[model samples]
Target: MNTISAKYKKDFNMDKSIEEKLVIRNKRFQSRLMLGTGKYRNIKEAVESIEKSEASIITVAVRKIEYLKKIGKSNLIDFLDWNKLWLLPNTAGCQTAEEAVRLATLGIEMNKKLGQLENNFVKLEVISDSKYLLPDPIGTLKAAEYLVKRNFTVLPYIYPDPILAKQLEEIGCHTIMPLGSPIGSGQGLQNFYNIKVIIENTKVPIIVDAGIGQASEANAAMEIGASGILLNTAIAKSGQPKLMAEAMKLSVISGRKCYTSGIMTKQIQGQASSPYYGIPKLQ
Candidate 1:
């Protein structure tokens, strides 16, 4: 049973700006910074870090829970806060269409606690490989098209391939996320130029997700006009996760500011600010 409790149909008809940019579930956020809610040592730390960062949204993975005979059962319920920032449940482990669909249905039911079904906010993460962790684009495309028909806010994580991005858009992804590097490698922007092209040509928000190593890299992505960034290990695995979260928050804001304000042009030949005409000896 596809028990989607997304209240969007009853409450939201999907609003658009005059420029037709899709409003984020009727929220006024032009900033493209997306945060992950995994890898924190504890739920409290995760919540506190995310809150302190002041991120507009946080992504969480919907996976399995093991039941211990001694301890009974405990899911990732510790991470749930119905009152916090918008919940973005990702199908992180699904590699096939069947798995994705089953999990997506479970997510809808599980998300009722977090109010996801009501809001229609879910990010689809379909990875086929356990080793390389490559997304099954075929599965992703199928899932994306299916989810869109079902009225879910779909964001797909993909490699820096522009045509795949276009295919995703064609199937109804509201935004496409191109990886900055491998997930959790902190390798920085490995496919920088391709990401730029994706950002340039995509109609939807072009989110640079994964493999961001530092605040400077986040800034670079924004400078290139990426809609926003989604990061995890870069902040979560930091020596001081809380402090790192704060740094990332400011970096995003600073990047947005720099991007909006045109950068100073690069020059190969030195063009003196004090002209030869202005210098007394030269004059």
Candidate 2:
């Protein structure tokens, strides 16, 4: 077992050497795993988990922060260190294009307060469906167009639809975040085929967002050529958020390395690792 483990470790190290940084909208990110600042039991746990994840880009729901401040409760921004982390403000709870645009505008102000003067990154989400939490395509497209016109680096979250992804890219979205499954369901890549198509067709980054419940799921998405991942519940709702975050970080790195190293093609029949012709005539 030790020998087998050592062999994998050596191979992974070689693969890691050729791994490239995840670039989105001209900004380079060393870690392809982007974490959300929600669902944790406490702020301390959330901060610790973010540290363990080693994710440079952190997504925060602008409405939640605003509500917390309005209620006189501590908000996520107060705890995060702006110097080390880049904020990806999201319009999570907005159900309409107008509402999403409004929240995105507020997010820009929030970023300005965080000392991100020129930062305009916004994760645009427009969902009217409460039960499934599925993004509304028409609303999302409308909001994305408005945001893009205002020069915001929009990263819209949507279902794994190849056509919509191309439209978003054409409209100047920095990245396309396709749901792996329903939000927080942990179903893990239910739309794997469509996502692959999106990755193949689009020129922008394809980030697998939501429904990734474990490290293996995260790895699977990255291995299939996803540019990055944005997950919250899998880490925040885990038994040990910190440990799970670390697992996710390593899994993203391993998956990216595998993709960059060029994974072996699938074969229908089993083949011997060693050449079969080297043996002498034997009884």
Backbone clash count, each prediction separately: 4, 0
Candidate models: Cα lDDT each: 0.75, 0.92
lDDT of candidate 2 over 143-253, digit per residue (tens): 999999989999999999999999999999989999999999989999999999999999899999999999999999999899999999999999999999999999988
TM-score of 2: 0.93
- Using TM-score, give the best candidate's number: 2
Off by over 4 Å in 2: 1-17
What's the TM-score of every candidate structure? 0.83, 0.93
Angstrom error of the Cα, residue 95, model 1: value is: 1.3
Which residue pairs clash within candidate 1? 5-117, 6-117, 7-118, 32-228
Q: Which ranges in model 1 have alpha carbons more than 4 Å from their true place?
A: 1-22, 64-81, 275-278
In Å, residue 57's CA in model 1 sits off its true spot by 0.9
